[model samples]
Target: MTGLRERKRARTHAAISEAAIALFLERGFDEVSVAQVAEAAEVSKRTLFAYFPAKEDLVVHRFADHETEAARVVLARPPDAGPLAALRDHFLDGLRRRDPITGLNDVPEILALTRMVVEAPALRTRMIRFQEASERALAEALQDTAGVPALTARLAATQVVGVHWLLSMDNSRALLGGQSADERCPAAVADAGHAFALLSEGLAAHL
Candidate 1:
């Protein structure tokens, strides 16, 4: 169970993020300053910075939650489960749950956040960095698995993560075009199946 102090801190953190995102969505990402976000959240500039180290972070903080998710998925898979199988299953599950990274979420506020990230230059660059970090972490996970060469793991990570990136963009486009999650889900699932089938061609022999 979380202590009072920790719960209070979580509430404050959520407040700051919510305030920052609302401001950015209303006024645009570049126009909203850090001080303004702090004021709106009823926190100090120091506290805001403590929660989000950079301006781009306010919008992209959610990405931090999944920074090493691929690694964790791969590491925790059953002994007999191939790495590719684990990833494919994980992504498919995300699609079912309408996970944001899977681009299956149709929530208005979530769509707004996606638009904010897509339209902002800093957020785009930071997103690329986060994707790279995820890939690097997955590569390390691959290396830790037996019979997988370091180079092979790196190559595999790149190929796998590339598919995920493309899927996210496709889902975002469909959502922004006004498709709801229920409408987009079948296609999303189909697309994911196709993607993994294609990946398995070159990657099957390796994993």
Candidate 2:
């Protein structure tokens, strides 16, 4: 069946990603070869490439869903919900759930990956590029939902996404500094709530 085939593909993809992360954490992102990852996952290099096109994708693939998620939230917002309010609610919900995007899911392996990215110039650049793409996707969604000017949508998306990036960096720093998830998550959630509130105040007042 198509569904069964898809599930098998999904499992293979996850196995490759998990193996890639493990090797990257152990040997540094820049030092780990695609062939090495394929071997670790027990898949051929071609198969790995079929799943993730580039080396950067091995780590950043986790973020690919964000673009779709942003659009989906905006498109499905309650009739009375303004764009800013909808995004605020969405982010708050994620924070309460301690989602990784909020920097609350501070697993040791994730922290190691963060350190690897921080130390690698190429990875850092790729992350910035990914964030820009996510912002553009979110901006387009906001523009469609609110019928706002392009600039307004862009500015709003930048503000919200920038806050999220900062929060993720803060959480990574806390974890790298030896803070446990249990110790860091509540504080990160509270801090993110305050940050979103500040953004909401300005966003609601302006556009």
TM per model?
0.93, 0.85
- Given candidate 1, what's the lDDT at residue 34? 97
Residue-level error in angstroms, candidate 2, position 36: 1.1
Which residue pairs show backbone clashes in model 2? none
Locate the minimum summed-lDDT window of 10 residues in model 2: 102-111
* Residue 181, model 1, lDDT: 89
- Cα-based lDDT for every prediction: 0.90, 0.82
Model 2, residue 108: C-alpha shift (Å): 2.4
What lDDT tens digits, residue by residue, belong to model 1 across residues 179-206? 9989999999999999999999989998
List candidate 1 stretches off by more than 4 Å: 1-5
Candidate 2, RMSD to the unseen true structure: 2.3
Best by lDDT: 1
lDDT of 2 at 102: 61
- The Cα RMSD in angstroms, rounded to one decimal, for candidate 1 relative to the true structure is 1.9
**Across residues 30-129, which tens digit of lDDT does each residue of candidate 2 receive?**
8989999999999999999999998999988877777556667888999987776777688768766767766666666666777887788888888888
